[model samples]
Target: MTGKQHLTGKVEALEGTKILCVGDVMLDRYVYGDVERISPEAPIPVLRVKDERSMLGGAGNVARNLAALGAHVAFASVVGADEVGEEIERMLGNVPHLQASLVVEPLRRSTVKTRFVAMGQQVLRADHETSAALTSAAQTEFIDRVRGLVPDVQVVVLSDYGKGVLTPEVCRAIIDVARAAGVPVVVDPKGRDYSLYRGASVVTPNRKELAEATGENASGDEAIVALARKLIGEAGIDAMIVTRSQEGMSVVMASGEVAHLPAEAREVFDVSGAGDTVISTLAASLAGGLSLVEAASLANTAAGIVVGKVGTAVVYLDELAAKLRENELSSIESKVATLQAAQDVAASWRARGLTVGFTNGCFDLLHPGHVALLAQSRALCDRLIVGLNSDASVSRLKGPTRPVQPDIARATVLASLASVDLVVIFEEDTPENLIRSLRPDVLIKGGDYTVETIVGADFVQSHGGKVAIIDLVPGFSTTKTVEKLSR
Candidate 1:
């Protein structure tokens, strides 16, 4: 495949893959409020706390990110016998498509990072944890869990947070097992000594971590590559990625090839846990069979998104896909047309040996569920055509209060999505006329419907077209959103 097509294909290729993440796990707590006045007794500000949230941190964050990117992650970590540990374990258990093997160390305390924020900015941070190395027994138990996971996982991520969980012995044991299993190991290295991570496939470090590990001043790319190569040599790893915040990230391979990916332009709000985002994206991309450069580029985009978000956030598959499609917007713009224009495009696509899929909806209020449906629909075919119900048809089917957004606006939004190739608006109550005109190779619907019940199903079948049904995302509907607003 061409390089550009290969890179874009990675987004869809990341689904349903399994990744194993092993390292430090922590609970992140955020306290949001407005700091109005100064305290009378002390010199600190008197803040009115408004909201609080807790999320997976450290290695756990990496697992969450992998899950968000559509991978089934096996997370193995060591917690403690505290309530925070209990809470985090319960939370991790609820993460969809993630299996956890959390071993508890009675002598240690669970790691918890508390951040107090005001005006979308962190004011103070507190930590409750231990940095003591694991006992020999605990280390062995943890390594065994990871070794067990290696058989099922396509890639292994050593998400080190400098916590005692990833002590040298644990790192070495996991790497050896993974290497023996023929699984690629991606280490988010911690501490100054890179020797612990020796013989791994790749290591990811930020500018600060890279500089600290090698004591190399990163004034330029050549200097950074020179220093990163030094660490790669000493650690015996295959490659290194040094992430520079605004200047982007660099990939230095052991074979003396260096690649630089410019940072995705984003308005940074908070950079909390962006490093976790990087490693998770890198591992997922590599597991998706992307080249090292493609993986680094995808990781850079993911990190840029996380830094722009409000708090510790993940890069979802749809979000990343949308970002990747932004580069192809110019090509998509040419696909928007009327009935004749859409027919022409479909003929051309068929001539190129492409399978065309068709799905239609009012799409008055675009939500994650809609995006998910479109994404899955596109995955079933080479090209997808979306038939949008015009404003009058939407009002006729969905009532007068329907179509929260106008037809033109809705069409624009639908066209912008990556899963869509061409859009044709129909004035009829159903997309039957449009379907007959388009003659797509496949007809798709997001709802559970039988062939006899779906609109234009017989017509499609009579013309030898296949029908596909993708289930709807639960708890999401335009009517529900409007009702919630009214309430």
Candidate 2:
């Protein structure tokens, strides 16, 4: 079934699902700097540190994603009794309904992946960690704690980064406890052995891991499907999802049913912890009763969103809803603006007690469909905001030599329309982020969209908003107008 048909039931189930994530947790530290001078000893430029920040990594990132997706998430992981552990706690504290329990190992140094970025590019990365297996006593204590939480959760995720917390015994103990309690277990495995994850409900592996463990180079679509099936059988997992960067993912069910999901990413800025996003989303969806197919699809879309971010990040429920809305409007809405301005404009719409219906377009030339859609959009709400593409944004979406009119001219023409209440221009090719910022109460598109096709439909619908398809006016379009003019 399509995403929309399954969405209603799946989302309703999410509110009741509780998830527990336990595994290797790390702190991701970023040191931002500027390279103004070169070092005499080496060819590297000297970096003047400007800022330092830290976020949750590994299993902690999984827990963050689960919480952001509205699951009642409890994280159980080991942290060194140190400052990095304290900072990790502080970050996780900000998430609502998420609780973190730590087993501090005095002897173990907390895992920290610190990267130095200069002008948005990573200059170098430094790691502070230990990959040795936990002591037998520590492993038993961790298992007891996870067992205590297992009975209360509907699903469990074991995020093994090979950072020492997740040993074979720990994985087995988690799986046993979860199975005993009739709860689902999912794993993000590390190292070369697939046998460690035997009996998991699902195991997610990236292309490299899958290739390494299965001894099969699952590069093309057919090979991925084949490998997923083989691994599911060999590892005894109920299902397997192999994450293919840029290409999305392929899910293989225990019954050998293979489903392929395409990546929805328009741009990929950084893909530091996209796997965490996938596993987190899948666990929540499964706990909420989504089928393997439905859950995997949501995971695919969510991962696509996170990779566009700069570092390890979580996908907000509201952001997902906005992405769905934009997908719904792609055929109709055009033009784009900076995310900050888009948010400000969206806030303005919210305060007016008017449901600002938004739809964008290139509007290269004002045409009858544009006027009709704007009028119809205005009819749905007290006001209508037209998101236009700046000349640059348009060139990214449409080709160069396009936008027949500049952004300023297009804005002037759109502003002149009696139906258009406001106009905001965005710079990105897809208005995914812009739609997220504007978060219009009602998203208007042409009749061409289904609930699934609407980019921000999920975001809007999740927030009690509606998406409508307005009929296009006949004999309209910039392309047609251009054709006539050229003739």
Candidate 3:
């Protein structure tokens, strides 16, 4: 697909999608150590500790991804009234646009997963958590909290790690409230009892969980598909997503259609929080206006970017964009994949009060006029995406010999500039559609065109955006250069 069509779905997925996450929250602790030699007492290797750190995990990881995606996230979970819980709240508070409805159950312990890493490999892991159900009072409080937020939120995400926080009663109550309010609910379910998530709009379970839940581990693909079909029918759910480690994800829709997304990560390190990332992104995108297929594709791309790093990790938009830029541009599928990977990062930057400026041109040759105009555009925004006309488009606008330089060469030159955050090629006659899809905060043109004449001026103005124009350096012009050289 072309750049225009590729980014259409992804861009639509960012319009005021507020998400509420309710489930298990855990602190991920990593103990980094060095193993030098074997101990004389036994055949075990001794590891000398160097450092330690902790991060949010499980449902908390889902919250992190939601925040990273620029969603208004309200987190509801159970934690002990201890120092660990205090630290977790502090961390949550530090994230922008995050709110919490935390319940302190004195008897329950905060869940924590501790991993020992030596020489880039995990040696062992220890989990500290409670698996017992919450008390009736606690469940009531959880339901009330969710009910209060249901009217404002667009979607609810339940991240179940088999921890005690997500009891059956609490899940049902919250789901009922969300349903009554006409909001969607997604669940990252665990264990053999999928019935707990019966009324959910969608539930994500891995291959193992699905097999165990339906008692069909050793069945064929048709059997698994049939079982998933049965579960979706019996539970009255809209969809079911089955996450297969290397094989990818299979999405079964209520329409009896199934779509499979092939995994795209080049490298895999720690798969700890990958599931949370996938489910969180999927729910947020769907709430934001993307179709189920589009949301699943975006989630798959986010997962691909995270597994390349170790431990529980989040994928930033800039890093993802850079990765996309490094890879070769091919079909529409590839372009969409790249954009999905960078969607959240771009949204986060926008949330931080950063203005995004966009401009497009043939820019066949680098001249002082081009430099001065680009520099001025960069001054108005935190980042710029320079759209370049394709070879065919450039040749059509100018003559066949007018370019004198290839499109790739021009793109390479533009990409090297410090002001250019991203470069996309358009084969069309005008960049009106591209600008409209991007919906940049500022639209910049080099010449003295009136704001009304700008292709995307109406869109920019409608969204409280502005239009800017920069004067060219008097002595320099690509046309002038070509004329002088010819003479």
Candidate 4:
């Protein structure tokens, strides 16, 4: 069955999209440890800190969000002249292809939110900053910084934390200039006034924010639709996406078309920065030319990935792609089997219109070369079956001293690999009988052997199965491994 794995192609298409993220950025700090007992002075749990880490938060996170998805992201924002500001600058430099045009205002204090966590739960939090509105001079300079980058960016993201960096004037100036340049704008809005983000192409607000902004508490679809339309008309915004907690997301377009995506039913470990994940994914997806509905769907998946982690987590493109692929076959263990059981499994894979491939080896001692072969072979077909040589077969082929690990151990190890879907023991020197019975669509071997010389190649070809050979990782073999152990 076709599944989310189809989006892997779309992820690859996100490479090189230029995204400009502008908004209030913050320094997110984490202190993790264990809480053994209550504190002596207070009734709170005593946390003995063991580790400390920090990351880009708020708008800086939006830059990471785009970079994580393989987009070229540049951040434009304001920071105070402090140690937290220095740390943020250093970390931003470390991110791949991420640049920033930051205005360091002397009067402002850099925003820093430090959380004290114990056993993966937040025990306490500390905030240090000023949320006062930006001065007229600062707002003008901020707009100048963002306006200079608008023409070069494919998408402009205004990530507002209500931290005063995104003043109404700054927001209007940036949106107007960006729109004039034909660049679409996305906003993670804050404050009660929807007019601040009037010209933005999309405004993402949480359920609570949506209610507070519109002063409506009706939870039904009709009520939410009515409220969203009211805001869209009054604010002159193009669309609104309400990120409802547990109830899922409702996307309302100015054209009165609404699309809702159900909340992913999974054990959410933490909801920190999930909104950042949503906006970043939306920005990248939109820059990649997906429709509003398509972009939200992809953003929804990205949010699902982040909330499963324990902190203000960001989803990487490769990890998201892998998750989609893994979702295709939920029960992978069902694919592993012995010869008799493999027949039914192969039939099941075929019935689902999936292609099957076969490979065989003694696999007495697994190494990267073996792993590479299996991974590469699996790429050729949907299902991969590893024909393992039994203990007797190994002794006959390698010598009495061989079959070091035994058949069961070798089979278990091979089956544990993500690429090897099945492991079937074969007593014969070759997998001739097994191949003839399964008749896989393709037979794979290491590049060291030719198709004519590979065992079962002729039979596979006679049955309309093709032979494939993959390049081996250099300097990797059981012989070399055993030689090192002897020393």
Computed on alpha carbons, the lDDT of every model, listed in order, comes to: 0.85, 0.80, 0.78, 0.84
- lDDT per residue (tens digit) for residues 72-174 in model 3: 8889998887888887888888777789889888888888889987767778889888888888887788778878988899889999988888888888888
Q: How many steric clashes between backbone atoms does each model show? A: 0, 28, 2, 0
Off by over 4 Å in 1: 1-6, 328-487
Model 4 per-residue lDDT at 359 = 96
Candidate 1 C-alpha error for residue 27, in Å: 0.6
Our model 3 lands, by Cα RMSD against the true structure, at 13.1
Clashing pairs in 4: none
- lDDT tens per residue, model 4, 295-393: 887888888767766556677776566556665544544444557456645644553446789999999899988999999999999999999999999
Clashes, model 4? 0
Error of 1 at 382 (Å): 40
Model 2: lDDT equals 0.80
Summarize candidate 2's per-residue lDDT along 33-82 as a digit string, tens digits. 67899999998889987556678899988988888788899899888789
Give residue 335's error in model 4 in angstroms: 15
TM-score of 2: 0.68
Which scores higher on lDDT, 1 or 4?
Answer: 1
Off by over 4 Å in 2: 1-9, 329-487
Candidate 2 at 232: error in angstroms? Answer: 1.8
